[model samples]
Target: MKGKISLDLTEGSWTASGGLTFTKASDGRTLRFTGAHGDLAQRSMLVDATVGDEATLPVDLSTYELDMTKITVTMPSVNSPGSVEGRPFSTTLKPDGAAVFSRAFGTSPVPTGSSLATLAGRVDVVPGLG
Candidate 1:
């Protein structure tokens, strides 16, 4: 089955829009993600750089397995101008139904200063009919 996954960053004004294609398997299910594409806008603090525009980042889908509550995905190292780019990152999804999604990035000091860092909000999953 094919579907779209959308995420919203709760701490700030960043949102992620992406697509996922799932295939049924003997063990469980396999999910492939297109990418995490979205926009970022800073509304609280003033910065020395531009704060709003289109952003596209690759998500690692090789290690994902369908689960009851949680699924982990990676964000490859990015080097885009005027955007938050760094070494490869990963986030986990704990979805309640197909509308709300909550996620966190990495396993260290915690994500700070970017929407991709910490995310929590609604995700609209639209399934495609076969």
Candidate 2:
């Protein structure tokens, strides 16, 4: 079986119930998720970054403290429970490259409860010699 790598995140559900969790789904690569807050930030973070709209994300594989060629994600829903609004949401990676999804609906102030305004995405590391 192939190893998987990913990062997960959540909002509102931090103290009592909800929270984000980032893990390597496949042993493809190692990723990190750093946000403004611990909880209201990303509950879980992964590569395989997918968006729900047609947006463009900047790619620079020379700053993330890592190295890579391409970064893709599963398009996020603009109108969903944990979707984000606005087009072109970006991320700053380390050692290598970065990516972002736009028109998200979960990038706003989170509400209170186990359920929160969520923004989920992923990043896929192009096969490379590690």
Candidate 3:
């Protein structure tokens, strides 16, 4: 649940343009999403993602299992001029064993911990457990 996530940036094809210009500003650049490699760790629940695309993974968040619900995307700030931050978004798991995740900014997006209370059902089950 709590660990470092490293994205394989080399595997994906990212396009870079320019940043804002006009007055004391560099040309605004846009880094679009391309591809990804999820769940690097064998114990972790990995999910592959792409730009303009969405993916879902059944993460077992119970009993300290490795579950990756989202990604931490770092991008240049358009509003703040120059900065970056975590943009956690929605990740839903369906009753039919399907999980749906999204990344709007085309960057690494993390799962919303606040909305994961219900998603904590993918834990491992013991053989003799009732």
Candidate 4:
């Protein structure tokens, strides 16, 4: 998750550019996303990090001071013009450092509503790590 990013909560959008990688700690299988471009905002973030080998999943984002959760969401579709009770998530990612069907997914603690956003920039994503 090293690179540059711009967030616009008012617009409910975000953009990212950098390198991303997903590592499977159980077997040391790394899925790297190079020259990554991320998208996130509101309650949902779409990331298209290229997958590869040799990466680390046990990453500590707390050191970056960037909190993905508690992000401002102002979408009218969610039935809650604004709320921080939910976060973006992905239901995709294979056990072999790959994503299934679509490179898209959503997270848990769902607010039982609708959401969408972009986290622009290259980012490392570990399944179940967030």
Cand. 4 TM to true fold: 0.27
Give me the overall lDDT of model 2: 0.27
* Candidate number of the best TM-score: 4
The digit string of per-residue lDDT tens for model 4 on 1-130 reads 3322233332233344566554555654444443322223323334444324323332111101134563543433434332232244333222222231122222222222222122222233222214
Q: Candidate 2 lDDT, tens digit per residue, 33-96?
A: 2222222233232332223322423222111111122223343344432222222333333221
Tell me how far the alpha carbon of residue 83 in candidate 4 is from the true structure, in angstroms, after superposition: 20
TM-score winner, 1 or 3: 1
Candidate 1 steric clashes = 0
Segments of candidate 1 deviating more than 4 angstroms: 1-11, 26-81, 95-130
Predictions in order: lDDT? 0.27, 0.27, 0.26, 0.32
List pairs with backbone clashes in candidate 1.
none
Error of 3 at 18 (Å): 37
Backbone atom clashes (below 3 Å) for every candidate:
0, 59, 12, 23
TM-score of each: 0.23, 0.17, 0.18, 0.27
Which stretches of candidate 2 lie above 4 Å from their native place?
1-113
Q: Residues 1-130, candidate 1, lDDT per residue (tens digit)?
A: 1223322222223233455433444433333344343322212211111112213223321111222134233322334211122233333322211111112111212233222233223332332349
Location of the lowest summed lDDT over 10 successive residues in candidate 2: 59-68
The candidate, 1 or 2, that scores higher on TM-score is 1
- For model 4, the superposed segments whose C-alpha errors exceed 4 Å read 1-12, 25-27, 33-42, 53-130
